[model samples]
Target: MTPAVPRPASRPRLLVVSPNRSHLALLARRLGAEGYAIVTAADGATALGELRRSPIDLVLAELVMEPMSGPELTRAIREQLAFAEVPVMLIASRAEADPAVRAFEAGAEDVILKPFHFEVLVARIERRRAAAERVASMRADMKAMDARAAMKAIELGELKDRMYQLEAERRRVSA
Candidate 1:
């Protein structure tokens, strides 16, 4: 019996943060062409600002940067209640340097090595989003079940009350 709550807009938005200028643009351009609403930032500070300002569905950041690194950004994002479900991926600049372990510790979904295929990035994004959507659907289903259970409890209480009244009436009639 609760009023309908207006849902947030469903647009898929991504924030790409990197101190490197070249590949950042490439990612932005390609991902934008792929129909993502892209937001770009040069560092984690700017990215955090953008996250606060808009509804970002995903984040792609460099593994290392100045003023705020990928791990810092991931930690900050995770600390916020609103961004808890948002997925973050960190891109490493060197093949020999794998930040996967540290990135995971910082709450990043994955660390992408340099020279990664754009297709792989897109696939990861798709999988993350699919999993998130599934979780959201499950939460809604749970809420409905909880409400139904509460209503059933109320009905059972009323039925028991009626039964008790019927027994009392029968006893009085017999007496």
Candidate 2:
């Protein structure tokens, strides 16, 4: 067996789904070598099952597969709130525009054509990962901001109540 690639704890976990066994193996090996933890699924159903089983940072699926095409799988994933934010990249066996367009419409983050250079594929994956990280960071910042705003609103309300009480007390004392 080949030695496992040394990966950092923060490395993204990738789910690779393909009906073709060879294709799946190739992607798993190549991507694993690039320091990504890979989980393989032979079809869309298995892929969905894998998603439910564990957290996956990204999904790489073949464009065409039985039971569910890449676009169909993407739609299914998007329908689930937990998996909706996971970026999906589809691999097309041919340079057809229709399938690629469908993949995009279904919410895939990227679509790579077959015969692509390995370097390009890796680069695309890195780009997607980076984009996802940025989005997550922004979401965290928004949540924190919202929390602060809520606290401020509560504090303002308390201050207003105190002022009202003070005004009532002063009027009584004057009278």
lDDT of each: 0.86, 0.92
Please report the candidate that would top lDDT against the real structure.
Answer: 2
| lDDT string, candidate 2, 1-175, tens digits | 3444466787789999998899899999988888898999999999999999999999999988998989999999999999999999999968566877899999999999988988888889989988998999999999999999999999999999999999999999999
| TM, every model | 0.84, 0.93
Q: After superposing candidate 2, which stretches have Cα over 4 Å from the reference?
A: 1-7, 95-97
- Number of residue pairs clashing in candidate 1, backbone atoms closer than 3 angstroms, sequence gap of 3 or more or interchain: 0
Best by TM-score: 2
Encode model 1's per-residue lDDT on 47-114: one tens digit a residue. Answer: 99999999888899998989888999999999999998888999886654548877999999878888
